[model samples]
Each structure stands twice: as structure tokens, then as C-alpha cells.
Target: MTHQTLPTGSVSPEQAAREQSLVDEVVASFAGAESPRLRELMEALARHVHAFVRETRLTEEEWAAAIEFLTAVGHITDDKRQEFILLSDALGLSMQTITVNNEAVGAATEATVFGPFFVEGAPRIELGGDLAFGAKGQPCWVEGTVTDTEGRPLPGARIEVWEADEDGFYDVQYGDGRTAARAHLFTDDNGAYRFWAVTPTPYPIPHDGPVGQMLQAVGRSPMRASHLHFMVSAEGQRTLVTHIFVAGDDYLTHDSVFGVRDSLVRDFALQPAGTPTPDGRDLGDTEWTRTRFDIVLAPAQTASTS
Candidate 1:
């Protein structure tokens, strides 16, 4: 194709420069137009997006496809799920953002992505109660304590936990009530907690969407290492959303979302069956897994201090 350059005299150099000035003026017009933080975010986003377009020499075709991909992502969202969040996970953006915002708070626990599968109002159960809801898998005895940075027990910390079954699928993902994998529990006076559940298995992220296409294009797998999600909170302490990843899982070093942290990796010890629970229920004759983890939280920082 033959290209036609702009006529030499069609526009003056000053006019071209003025066009660039208009771009800045348009963006600046939005500054101070809303909440201060929002204004700053908008301005920075605009600057970076514009810079990216220029730096990449983005073409109309590429831009149109990008828009279409985003539109499809929006279409895939619903009350119980968010496709954009999945996209963020697949691209490692969600984990990166969380890590950036969670700079260590004096030995406080690390925070990780609250993935797309979280549902509010999980059933509340006492420490050591079963979260398995009678599902079949490698029984796991999970025990832990909630404490402050100074090692003081947090008597009433609430710990919300969830994980996949032996087949690597959440309860909600496998139809209603097929499993009971989500539970909420509170720390006792000694800050001790425990629960019985199935040992989590490594699973693949949903790879039936645009995110999957992108992963395939890059020759990346969509699998996440075995892990259990925990959201723990207590009065006067900062809430922490994190995961206890199984150490030595094949996918740990190559977590699709980059959510693995050395501090979060834990050993799941295999225990012979007949392990007795304090409640006197024989943990059956099947082999099980056991793990113990502790959570330490930082004092809540006010918005100004944060």
C-alpha cells in the first residue's frame, strides 16, 4: 500500500505542537474534579495509558481487539463471579497489587489476592469443628493460633477459611451443597483454633475464556498450587487475607498468579488414620494430612496513618 504523507504546508509545526498541548489540557481538566485520591488515580492512569499507546505504537486494529477482549470480560461477570478478577489473577496483576499494598507491618502476616471465588456469609463454626461437610478426600487436621505482632493471643479473632476438595473444586463450583468447604471460626481465649477439612489439591484455573487464550499463546499453564484461603480479623488489628500454600507442590514455583510466598508455604504431614479428636470422634481408618499455622496481625492503621 502506498502511504501519503501530510502536505508540507497543510499544518504548521506550531499547530502540531498545539495538538499535543490539547491532550495535556484535556487530561488536566479532570484534575481536582472529584475526590483527591480518585483525581490522582485518574490523572496517573491517563498519563500511563497514553504513554503506553505511544511507546507501543499501538495500531487501530490492536486497540479494537483490546476493547473487544475487555468487553467480553465484562460480559462474563456475575453476582457470584468476576471474570475480570480471574483475568487479573491469570496475568499476576492481582497478586502484584496486593503485595505492593501490603508492605510488611512490623512482622504482620503477608496478604495475598482474595481470589474471585470468595462468597460472603460463610457458616460460622467453633474451632475444631469439621468444615468438610462429609466430603471424601484426604482428611486434614488444620490447627492454628491468631496472635498480635508481640505474640499476644487475639482471643476473639474471626478466621474465615475455604479450600477445594480432593478433586480440586470448590463447593459452590460443583453445584449447590455438593460439599461444605467454607467455614468461619473464632479463636478461643488462648487464641487457638482448629478445623477438620480435606487436604487441598492443586487445581487449574478456568481456562475457557480469553484469559485462557492468552495463557495458551504464551505457553503457560493455568494451574495453581494446593493451598487454603484464610481471612482473619480481630478488633484493633488489621484484617489479613492470605493463603497457606502446601510446600513442595509442583506448581508452587510456577503459581499461575504469583501468589506464593515463602512465609506462607507449610508442610502437610500425613497422619495415620484413627487420630483421635478432642470430641472423641475417631478420625476414621483412612490416612489423613495435618498442618499447623499461626497468624500474626498488625494493629489497625487509621486512614491517615495508612
Candidate 2:
């Protein structure tokens, strides 16, 4: 550990050349970490990030700016606002992490980022019921079935759905005591479920924060395409967290959170008035949109390994 001491506040050629070795020394120091996995991750992260810094010749000013940016992100975070998740989505790291954890084992639903807007305690609904109560949006009919990867029906599955109203506001966003757009329902014995909901509409990620400022600085849009969040689960099956996007949304290709997938997109078929209602909720001449998004889940055994 003994080494030649450079003069105070002075840099010599040999000392400058040894800067890279300091990174290696820090990486080796992580070997004594209590958790083997943690140690491994720290070592790998140190190596990769140190290489990035050296390769890019990152300046002190750039490092200071990064620290400031992350500090600002932290300052804006709260129970209702998840600035860290925003950061992950902005950099595409959230979707990339989801893609790594979820493999295409079969026709099962694809996983995506669990966006920050989801809230618990949504009211429960029957198989054929309306999810949007007092919500301001055009009526839409949504129905689907739950099945295993082999296509066997899974009855009694819990299907949780939530989305923004036509005004592009989630129930949690409104200060009023109203539960507009969110509910949970169970699949019937036939593995079929249906519910009336509002049409998904394009909305911006919660901006007005550091993340939003960064997006604007980079000339990027903050809009997420129209989509409904679904989290389905059944006994003996893996929980599936996903979203079904509107077929022709403008921001489909450029979702700010990068949660869109081709398989998850479905045509929101427009139904003209007088079409026989499935559950008979009695809507007068109002046209409605309909979509069927059957969900398939992998077995728990496979899910755990994945």
C-alpha cells in the first residue's frame, strides 16, 4: 500500500497514469461486502461505470451536473409523485428491466413497467359490470378471458383494471371525493369477464418536475399513448402486470414510458348504436367502443424461475 507521495496540490505524469488503477482498487475492496450478490453487483457496476467515465473522459463539471440533476429528481418525489420511476422511464431503463425479467414463454401476456399512478382499494365489480362510475368519458365495452399458456381457461382469476378518464385524469389526481375510473373483477366459471369502461385517452406523464424539465430540454414529448392497465392473477399462476393500448393512438410508437408492445395493442372496434348490449346496461343512442383482450398466464413454477 505504500506509494510515492506527489507534492501537495500538484499532479505528476506517473500519478495521472495511475488514476485508472484506483478504480480497480475500489472494485476489489467490494469483495468483503456481506452479501455475495451485492458484492458482485458493486464490483461489476464499479468496473463498468469507471470504464464509462474514463472512455468518455467525463469532466468534473459534468459529474457535478449529474449529481444536481438526481438531487432535483429526489426533491420532487412524494407519495403521489414517483420521480425515480420517471427517471427510469425517461432513460428507458424501466422497460429494459421488465424485458429482461419477463421472457416470451408462450402466448401469455407481456409484462411492462408498473407505472406510478396505480392505487389500491379500487371497488370490486361483478363479471359484467361497469368500472367507471361517474367518470367523464365515452362508454367502452371491455371483455376478456383468463387462460393458461396452454389455453386452458382459468376461472376466478382476479383482474384489476384502471385508466384515465376522457379528461386525462386518474381518480387519484382529482382532489374531489369521486372514484371515476378504476375497479377489480373476478373471472366467471367460464373464464370470461366483461365490464364497461371509458375509452383510454392519451395523457402526459406527471410533468412539472425535474423529469419533465429534462424531457423538454431534450426536445421530447411527455405523452403516454392511450392504454388501460391490467394486473391479473389466479391461483397456481404468475401475476401478470400489463397494459392494452388503443389501436391507433398517436403516441403508440413514442410512449414516454416506453411501455407499449405490439401484442398488447388491440383494435378498439366502434359499435354503432342499437347493437345488442351484452350485459344490458341500457345506453340510449350512444355509440361505444369494444375490445376483447384475453390474458394468458404462465404457471407459478415457470414464473419463479423466470
Candidate 3:
């Protein structure tokens, strides 16, 4: 007796083309959606996704795995944390998006990504105040002037500052009841601001999620360069979100997220105990590190007039 062979399940060329046509049809229907902004975003996303599928000829198993990964990312998020933001950071998308949105306006201060750690309503302190709150780390003094594009001081500029301890961990990471390493300070009449805090050290990003898994798979470390975060703004100038990186950090050349700019790296000098403070207050018996940084802002017309 002879047996008959059955047809294979794989699609023919014609069938594949028909499948693509269906995708295009569905994407085209989005033009009739009510929200203009949503429609625009969906259209762009659809175009890129369709192109990616076509280029890579992605498999069903790979697509399902991608969905599962994204679902896990969402499941891990809560009120005080965002796993997706961490994912964006590890992928360098966060910094890239910030760069795209914040173009330098005529030599204005550079803007960097605002990481997820900044909590609203940090306690405001006067210029020359101590942000360290007596925390443990090498003492560090940060003094800088906020200025407009023409080199004029911008008085009363609000500056928000935050950094990890010398051990490279933020208060939030250490749980509650800790307020030793963050503060908000306003510029003085001369556009000058000063604060005392612990020197920041290189720290690792959260490495217990999908993003972390990806990093391990690629043999990459998650440590960022030692740096201090700053958000500075004035009434008539553009807001600047940036970091002052410690010079000679091992990770400077290999910052996992590519956030380092040459102009932003600075040297921290060792000052003997009892060194005179900028405000004439003596830091007795406390050897400290000091660094001066000056931020230049662009006028309103040069800032966001674009």
C-alpha cells in the first residue's frame, strides 16, 4: 500500500506577502483614531516595528519572549520604584532622549538625564549650608556660580542637589529615616552657591532585573562614574540638569551609560583640616575635599525660544 505525503505548514511567498499586507492595513486604520498625538505616536511606532520585523524576519518564539520580558518589567514596578526607567537607563535610551529634547542653546549649560532617584521637596538650605547632615564620607565642598550666557550672575537661582555617600549609595537605597546626603540651595545675590557634602563615589545601578540580566549577558559592569547631580534654574534662564564627575574615576572612559562629558569632569583637591571655608566658617578637624564649578545658562531667548 502506498502512503500519501501531507503539505508542510510553513507559509509560501505569496502567503508571507499577504501577511505583511494585513499588518499595513491595520496600521493604516490608525489614521482614523481620535487623539492626534496618539495617532502620530502610533504611526511612527508602527512604521519602525514593521521595518524591524521585515528586516530581521523575527521568529514567533523570539516575539513571545520579548513580550514576557516586558510584562515582567511592568510587574516589578511599584509606587516608589520604576523598573522600566532602569531598563531605559541600562539601554542608554534615557540619556539619548534627554539629549534630543535639550539642545544646547548658544553655549548654555548641558542637560543630562534625570534619573529616577530625585524625590520631590527636598529640604531647602541656605547657601554655604551642609547637605551631608554629618554623614560618613570624605568631606566635600561644592561652590559654583550660576550665570547667564553673557557671563552675568543669575541671582536667586534655585539649585537642587543630591548624591550618594562615599560608599556609593543614596539614602533611598539605604531605606527610610536617612537624610544625610541631599539638599536644595538657592543662589545668592552674586549668583553664587555653596554646599558641604560627602564626596560621591562610583555606584552600580540596580542589577536584579531584566536589564541587569542583559548586562551580565554582555559581560558589562553596571557601575557609573563618581559624580554629583544638579538641577539648576533661574527665572529668566533655562534649567540645567547635569552632573559634575570626579576626575580620574576608573569608569570615566567606560561609563556604562555614556553620560560623561569632558567639560563636566573636575578634580577634587584634598584640603587640610581647619581649612578656611568660602563663607569664613572654619571646618575644624575635618579634612575635606573641595572643588569649584561654574554653570553658565542661556537667556530665555537663547534657552527655549526654539
Best by TM-score, which number?
2
Query: TM-score of the candidate numbered 3?
Result: 0.88
Error of 2 at 193 (Å): 0.8
- Models 1 onward score TM values of 0.87, 0.91, 0.88
> Which pairs of residues collide in model 2?
none
For residues 160-218, what per-residue lDDT tens digits would candidate 2 score against the true structure?
Answer: 89999998898888878678689999999989899999889999997899899999999
- Runs of candidate 2 with Cα error greater than 4 angstroms are 1-19, 304-306
Better of 1 and 2 by TM-score: 2
Per-residue alpha-carbon lDDT of candidate 3 for residues 1-306, written as tens digits (9 for 90 to 100): 111122235657776666567566757879898998888777767766765665566789989988998998888888867889888887888888878767777667777767777877888888778888766798888998999878889999999999888777788887866776888989989999988888879988877887778789899898899989999889877678899999999999877777888889999998888887677767689888889889987665554322
Clashes of 2: 0
Residue 87 lDDT (model 2): 91
Candidate rank order under lDDT: 2, 1, 3
Per-residue alpha-carbon lDDT of model 1 for 1-306, expressed as tens digits?
Answer: 111122233567675465446457656877667587777666666666765664465679999999998998888777866788889888888988887766687778888888766778888887779888866578788998999989999998999998888888888887665647888999999999998888888998888888878889899999998999999999998889999999789999998888999999999998777776545667677788889999998888721232
Model 3: lDDT of residue 149: 79
Alpha-carbon error at 117 in model 1, in Å? 2.3
- The Cα RMSD of model 2 versus the native structure comes to 4.7
**Can you tell me which runs of candidate 3 are displaced by over 4 Å?**
1-23, 272-286, 300-306
